[model samples]
Target: MPTDAHPAAPRPAVDHDVLIVGGGHNGLTAAAYLARTGKRVLLLERDDHLGGAAVSAEAFEGVDARLSRYSYLVSLLPQRIVDDLGLDVRLVRRRFSSYTPDPRDPSRGLLVDGEADAASARDAFARVGAEGDAEAWQAFYAETARVAERLFPTLTEPLPTRAEARSLIADEHAWDAFVERPLGETIDARFADDLVRGVVATDGLIGTFTDLDDPSLDANRCFLYHVIGGGTGDWDVPVGGMGAVSGELARVAREAGAVLRTDAEVVAIDGDSGEVRWREGGVDRTARAHVVLAGVAPVVLDRLVAAAAGTASGATEPSAGAAASVAPRDEPAAGAHSDEVPLDAGARHRLARAGMPEGAQVKVNLLLTRLPRLADASVAPEQAFAGTFHINELETQLDAAYRRAAAGDLPDPLPCEIYCHTLSDRTILGTGLAESEAQTLTVFGLHVPDRLVDAHGNDELRERLRDAVLASLDSVLAEPIADVIAMDAAGRPCIEVKTTRDLEHALNMPGGNIFHGTLSWPWLEPGAEAATPADRWGVATAHPRVLMCGSGAVRGGAVSGIGGHNAAMAVLEEELP
Candidate 1:
């Protein structure tokens, strides 16, 4: 084991073998791997702390709940990385995967139990007219598992050709349904129940704002990442919140001799020269490295480089919900939507062609005094909220919401998922709060697309959206969700809302996209057949030495360290001459 540096120790060497921009989890993962290889790695973050969006914090003032504010839950993080890094983290699997209450029948609801509870699992499916779907569900997931087994391990390895990958799966029908065809078509064909179909379809719309049957098959890309995580697609709750995950990664990196620094914002990167400029302690600083792995999104990297080279007006991009003439980078070929992004037409053209990924999801964290009474009296509140409690997420409901959102309007009844993390782990709440039956609830609203928010006046829009979400919740619950409140010191309800605007302003996430950008096919598609081995890793940039170690990489997005892992692999390997 390498010696670890004290947190208060002076900065290490200015020059390093690798300089990772952005002290996010992915950056920390890269630093850890590179350090293990005996490379001199240095990580820089703009914020005062590590763990970019993956950190847990006391969101509401005067509240003891340490919430996973930005990105919650873990599905993509590989256990292999945990073992390899010797990370001290525990992931608890909920016994109940989800419980969707039937609006037509308040007394009964669909409850998806863990695999061990086969009886309950069957009962839930049967109640929803998905008795056949239980078997179909198993068959469908078995194929995903096969795909996962074949594909997940390759994420850390060099990128394989499309043909090579297909040969490994060796299932033509599976490929056609999952890869070639629209996810909506596959979901409708596989499951007879509209409710069941919507449950599966939600995976495709996690962060993507697109039509289910869009020609680009963007939803398929999103769905694949959601399910293929760790080859099992099981989303587990991280013990001690998400901060534990990133904190452990930072520790592993530091223990392995990686120098980590926060509040050291990287202002510019010259990929050709392997030079990085940053601001620290009220002074500009420069560092040299053989490789510069950017943990930031591609659009951010472009702006940083452009600003340093005097091509753009400055480093800062326009805030989210704003109308910008210059397109966000790595956006789909849709169009430009953000306000005045001071970039050249060539740069804007590039971003426009990629098409912008606008976020539609709204995250709300609440500290409830006690669990609300469920409409389905048969199921205990503890079991119903333990995992995901589906509200207004039926197939027809989801379709209606999606259509409205796609038309730049907020859905009437927002399709959202609610889960109480405290039911599984009571450690998130303060001792005083935890003892008194206080719990933390995380609600994620779908179909509240970025277009719905008024960029110039989002406060009103956000308030309206929040009200709509609460109203939607009230429709399913026996009592109004707002009635059971834990007041703050100021006597206000202990609840915090995060809109797409909040994401954009707080985390610099353009259009509030949680995945950083639109999800793309992890492997080489038809047009990308010409990509090189490095390009296949999705880490390669126009500049040879500047690799993307963040969610922008191929097989990227989610909380998984695949992007970081692939970036490190790219650096360690030799390119084909």
Candidate 2:
């Protein structure tokens, strides 16, 4: 708590070119890239292991299932980074994109396949919607697919000027539909069916806490990242588990001579001097570097800076001509905060403007004795459960859930989605359980905002929400799902629910936001010019020596290491070839 980046006590010291805070995927990525470039790097993690929220674990005690607990799928990670690091990882394409059973008639459902079975897909869409709307669905996604192709490659490259990106696509309507207007307006104009429109709209609200009709266009930004993050907009499954991603990155970083320490909790940071103070082995320690890559939430960074402010020397005064260098010229002067200044004051201003990020998704992991029977008799459980299963997620229901949550209550059934990881990868289940009988079900509930937990508390609300979700699932199943649940050694059902509060406490994700901040468009305003090359990189902070390598940076959501890769690229002044 002393918050000394350069500990006054003069204990053992370590020196590195880059000191990375938080050993999540982003930090590991930064460390791996910088160390591979022959820069000395030191990475520290407070958790026992790395990967941050992109980790897999056995949520249920006495269960053999290793489920992707918090963050489930992979869509944002770039293949360029994968090949660059020579990561030994396997990503399996999902056979289907989603399957939604109609609550009115349980036997009816809509299924979207990955193999482009156009006739079958159109027929499925027609079951719950007009044939014309189904046709509109096809046209709409075709447009998004084009945007995906043109946009995803730019993520690894320098941040494109918004105009440059729009020019690359060469479609004014495409730009207006995705970038300029609210996504709900676009969804409304294209899709007529409530269920179909909701299916398309859900892409925009995964981790974002906002209304579909909100003018902020925050939902559009989230939708853009989801559809275009992987260059193809396809969300694949990491064969072993989500951990395979960060674990492989950790191996690469360590092999590259980057020093990594676990249980090393960073207490304070001096962004001006590029110094970090942390507690390791029950002792305070310090490290110095030319750069400090903060792979943490903005809230966490603020606390660290506030703690280190008192110890910082008279470097607080704004340096001569530093204003132009510290802030983007297109933005206001106040937007720039000198790295040499006492960051507490500036941090407060930015923190207030950034606002607190609150995640609205509930992660529920369940070990099933067998895949549940589907009410849609025509569709097999294997194919239906192979991808995302939507329950009470019609546009009307989804919108209603948002309103209900805003009014301090959970929806009647709670709009949610489910996927069985074992349907694609049996490696996660042990030998005895891998014989197709045992499986893992991961559920994500939407519109269950953080305030719900604050109002009900974790204990009372978790059970109520869990029961509602189970009942909702049963509404679409042939039989009660609870009957086929695998039991733990304690005879308890192998079901574990993690609320927003649970994530906040467990992962240190302020408000349980998986992205660490509100998702933003990858590019700056169309005509805005960057003040410096680092500004074009999008990873550089107002603090010159410190850069963001987390989800808070541009192009920095999901399991993507774009932020980490960009931060390293900025420090090394390296650009993609």
lDDT of all predictions? 0.79, 0.81
In terms of lDDT, the poorest run of 10 residues in model 2 is 320-329
RMSD of each: 7.4, 7.7
Error of 2 at 438 (Å): 0.8
RMSD of 2: 7.7
lDDT of each residue in 66-143, candidate 1, tens digit only:
988878889888878888889899999888878888655656778877764566667777876678888887788788
| Candidate 2 per-residue lDDT over residues 1-577, each given as its tens digit | 4566654564324477789999989999999999998898899999889989878887777777788888878888889999999999898899798998987688989888878677876787778755678778778888888899998999998888777888987889989999889999999998888888888899998878789889999899999988885767888889989988889999999999999999999988887777889998899998877788888876566556645675222123331111111111122234345666555644543433333467888888899999889889889998888888888888888888888889999888788889888989988887888975888898988888887876787899899888988998999999999998999988999989998879877887767888877776788765654775567778766577777888777788789888899888988883321
Q: What residue runs in model 2 are displaced by over 4 Å at the alpha carbon?
A: 1-14, 311-355, 526-529, 574-577
**Model 1 ranges with Cα > 4 A deviation:** 1-14, 116-120, 313-356, 526-533, 574-577
TM-score of 1: 0.88
Using lDDT as the measure, the top candidate is 2
Q: In model 1, what is the error at residue 38, expressed in angstroms?
A: 2.3
| TM-score of each prediction | 0.88, 0.89
